[model samples]
Target: MTTPQKIALVTGSHKGLGYAIARKLAQQAGIQVIVTSRKEQDGFTAQQRLATEGIQVDFHPLDVTNDSSVQQVTAWAQKTYGKVDILINNAGVNPTMQAEEASLLTMQLETMLSTLATNVAAVARITQAVLPLMQAQNYGRIVNVSTEMASLATIGSDYYPLAPSYRLSKIGLNGLTVLLAKELQGTNILVNAYSPGWMKTDMGGSDAPFTADEGAETAVYLATLPEHGAQGKFFAEMRKFGGPIALTW
Candidate 1:
């Protein structure tokens, strides 16, 4: 019997690292990539852009911060694909450039809450929405896009800025990854988080050294790990280290 194509859903993939990851996954055989964005036009534009390159992918509108949007997309995936084989929680926000984000004392409470809503809480919301499909198939690969700045070990000493909200939110995401992986132990559904590093994207800025495509390498690696592969671990960008290496949590 021929193996069925895997359905891979990537949130906020219209541009930047998420787009790079979606394009790479769609280029691979036996994978049906669903590129999603909050705006329908952006999603369709991204789909068209890939089509020009002979890479076909589906598009879905997903607002990870909205419960209704999450439910609607999950329903669409279930009806269209029967199961979701891969889920990349790539939708996130970094408001570090805001003056208030420069320090914890200056950080606005609302900004912190909003960051957590999308970066941390939205991940849990969407993961909870799509996990049933993975459970049904007894297979899955979940990759949470995280930043090494969130590492508790290096947060204090790292040269990176104190962007309190972004760091705290990602720390929450990392925690969620660990707890979710523990709950999924002894199963084919693997969940891992990886720091894509500082890449040149809208979020990373032009001065950054790496490209989004380069940053996306580890996401693809973690997304397509073999059964019984590393689970519940944090990884650095494979491009930087030449291979997958677990980062200190």
Candidate 2:
């Protein structure tokens, strides 16, 4: 019997790390990639760009922070694919460059709240929306895009900035991953988080040392992990260690 195609949904894939992850996932056999963006035009543009590369993927308008939008996309995926095998929570924001981000005392409460809303809460929102589908199929691979800066163990020693908002949000994301994996224990649905490192993306900026494609390496590995693979673990970029290496949470 032929294996059925797995449907993978990648949030905020219009550009940057998400786009690179989406592209790489689409390249895999037996997988249908769905590229989503908050802006419809941007998603369509990304869809076209990938098409030019001879890669075809579905497109959807998804604002992870919007309840209706998340519901709509989940409904579409269920109606069209009957199942969502993978979910890559790649959508996030980093306000480290802002002046307020330099110090916790100066960080605006609004900025902190917004960052948490997107980087942390939105992941929860979309995952909650998609989990039932994965549960129904008894198979899923969830890769949460996180940062090394959020690693609590290395926070005091890292050379990165004190962008309190971004760091705290990702910390929450890490906690979410661990807790979700605990809840999903004894199941095929594996959820894990990984640091993409400093990549050359809109958030990483041009001066960053790594490319988004390089950053996307770990995502592909986690998304295609075999049954009973690593769960609730934090991983570093695969390129950095030549394979998936667990990071200190």
Candidate 3:
């Protein structure tokens, strides 16, 4: 008998960490990877690029912040892939609120609200849409791409003002991870969050310590984990060019 193939949907996968994660997933056999982007053209191009490298990939257009777009993508996932065995919520925004702008950053409603909408709300919306499919499969792995800045254990009072919007939004995302894990307990589905660390991506910036591919390692690992894997925890890179290990919640 032929082994069944698992389907994975990775959001904001046109470039950066999301693209790397989608590529990593496609590298493994029996895993059909869906590479998504808010821009339909980007998604198509990414699929083509990966196909050139002999990867099995498909394109999907998704805008996590928009309800209609999220619903349309989720329905498309169901109709085409039948089920999304793994979900990598890798889409996020980190507005460049440099130290120079610290004083007014907090009060900047556009930056703060936009970050929350994409980083927190969209994560929940997409998960809610794909969750029933995961439940139906009785096996699912959801990896919420988070950041170390979100860690309360590490973020002292002094750190509160740094990237306030992005940090707070991730903390919110982490809460969703815990809540979802709890709701899906005693089942095969597992939900968790991990930090990809500073990588050389548009979001991470050019001076970031690592490359996008390196940063995506942990998310890929969590995406393929077994039923007994870690749940509702945050992870970060420990060793140089290594995968992520659990960090404090």
Q: What's the residue-level lDDT of 32 in candidate 1?
A: 96
> By lDDT, is 2 or 3 better?
2
Clashes (backbone N, CA, C under 3 Å), per candidate, total 0, 0, 0
lDDT on C-alpha atoms for all candidate structures: 0.95, 0.95, 0.85
lDDT of 3 by residue, 1-249 (tens): 212678899999999999999999999878998899999899999999998988869888999988999899888888887888999999998875555326543447777788899999999999999999899879899999998788888887534447777777899999899999999888889898988878898877798878998888888888988778887777785344355578887
lDDT of 1 by residue, 115-154 (tens): 9999999999999999988998899999999999999989
Q: Return the TM-score for each candidate structure.
A: 0.98, 0.98, 0.92
Q: Model 3: clashing residue pairs? A: none
Candidate 1 pairs with clashing backbones: none
Report the error of model 1 at residue 216, Å. 0.5
Q: Is candidate 2 or 3 superior in TM-score?
A: 2
| C-alpha RMSD for every candidate | 1.4, 1.5, 2.5
Model 2 C-alpha lDDT versus the unseen true structure:
0.95
